[model samples]
Every structure is written in structure tokens, then in C-alpha cells.
Target: MRHTLTLFVTLTVFWLLNSGHNTVLMTLLGLVSIIFVLYVAHKMDVVDHESQPVHLSLKFPGYFLWLLKELVLANISVVKSIWLGNSTISPCLMTIKSSQKTDLGIVIYANSITITPGTVSVDLIGDRITVHSLFKENIEFLKAGEMDRRVTELES
Candidate 1:
């Protein structure tokens, strides 16, 4: 019941914030839609309580700052390599270990890796992730385990 209420409230807030125009009827309609969604979710039994860990807390601001810095650095490196006009990009496949204990955490970590520039997660099995990096330096960074460590910390 708590999860359902949380989902409904989240959806309602998202709709209200995103809507350009405000109207009493529209707000009531949005609330109704949110309730309908919750009803459907309840009927489907797709909301796994086990997946929502109560103790999990992420330092989102720090993670976002770190991610932004890494993105900027990656963009600079890619631009430099492109301007050099040589085959400076070295593609390599490497495996990294994931320290996240939950399946959802592992999925998030893998997806985050794929979302970042210069690297792609090709496969994930158990705690191992196969990543394809555009450069050997990127592979080395992964092997250094900094990314994995940060993701594990976030998962916790």
C-alpha cells in the first residue's frame, strides 16, 4: 500500500510539474490517471517489495558531480583524439568485477557504464562485467576499480 501511494504521488507530481497549463479539471484527471496506474500495478503484481530496499541510501549530489566531471574529461579526450586525425583510439575488451550485491544494483551499474562515453558494457554475468573501451587508458581506469567502487557505494 505504501509503495502504491508513493508511485501515485510521484506520478501526480511529475504530471503537475511537466504540464504547461494548469486547470482544476486537468489536475483531477491527472490524479485519476495516477490512481488507475496504481490499480493496474497492483493487479499485475509486478511491484516486487524485495527489490525496494529500505536501507539503501545514495549520495546523489556527489555521484552526479563525479559523473559530470568524468563526462567533461571524456569529451575533451575524445575531441583531442579526433583532432589529432590519427588512429589514436585503441579499442579493447576487458572484464571488471561488480561489487553490488543486488541484481538491480548490478543492472544500474552496467547501464551507467554503457551510458558513459568511451565505454560500453557488452555483457554482465553474476558479478562480472565485460566492457569494451575506446582506449587502453579507459580499460586501465576500469581495471583500477574506481568506477565499480563508486557504483557499489551508491548501491549501498
Candidate 2:
């Protein structure tokens, strides 16, 4: 029931912000669309915790800020490597272990790896993830487990 309410409010806000139409007709249309979406989602049984993820809301901002910082640092590292030529690149394919207890947490860890400029998550199975990185240091960074720890904390 709470999830449904949250979804409804989220959809309404999203529609209002994106549509940017204040007229009655537009408002009615948006409401209709939101209702249709809610009905379909209820039927599909996807409007649960995984879909809404309200549990992660409190920790998400901190994780996002960390991710943003990592993104900038990775961009700089990649650019520096490019300027220094291929000789400075040490590409590696390695498998790393993840400690996250949920599918969402594992996915967040894998996606975080893929999002950072120098690394790509190639595969994820159970608690293990295989990654390909432009720089060996990127793989080492994953091995260090700070991002994995943070994502685990987010899920907790």
C-alpha cells in the first residue's frame, strides 16, 4: 500500500515536471496516464521494493556523491593515459569478489565499475564479477573493495 502511494506520487511528480503544461486538459491527461501506468505496474507485480527502492533513498545521495567524484578522477586518469600514449596503458581482465548480499547491491557494484571511465564490468555471476579495465590500476582499485563496501552499505 505504501509502495503504491509512493509510486503514484512519483509518477505524478515526474509527469508534471516533464510535461510542463498547466492547463486542465494536460493535467487530466497526465492523471490518466499515471493511472494507466499504475494499473499496468500492479498487474505486472513489479511495483515492489526492488522497483521503488525507497529503502535506498537515505544512502543514495552519499553514494552518488562518491560515484561522481570517482567519475571525475577516472576521467582525468583516462585523459592522462591517452596523452601519454598506449605505452602507459596496462589493460587487464580480472575477476573480483563482491560482498553485497542482495541482487540490487551486486548490480550496483557492477554498474559502478562499468560507469567509471577506465573499467567495464564484463560479467556478474553470484558474488563474483569479471571486469575488463584499460589500466591495471583500475582492477586493483576494485580489488581494494572501497566501492564494494560503500554499495553494501547502501543496500544495508
TM-score of each: 0.86, 0.96
Local lDDT at 56 for model 2:
96
Poorest stretch of ten by lDDT in candidate 1: 49-58
Tens digit of lDDT per residue, candidate 2, span 1-156? 889999999999999899988999999999999999999999999998888889999999999999999999999999999999999999999999999998888988899999999999999888999999999889988899999999999999
Which regions in candidate 2 have their CA more than 4 angstroms from the true location?
none
Local distance difference test, candidate 2: 0.94
For model 1, which pairs clash?
none
Task: Give the Å shift of residue 47 in candidate 1.
Answer: 3.0
Runs in model 1 lying further than 4 Å from the true structure: 48-58
TM-score of 1: 0.86
Q: Alpha-carbon error at 32 in model 1, in Å?
A: 1.2
lDDT of 2 at 16: 89
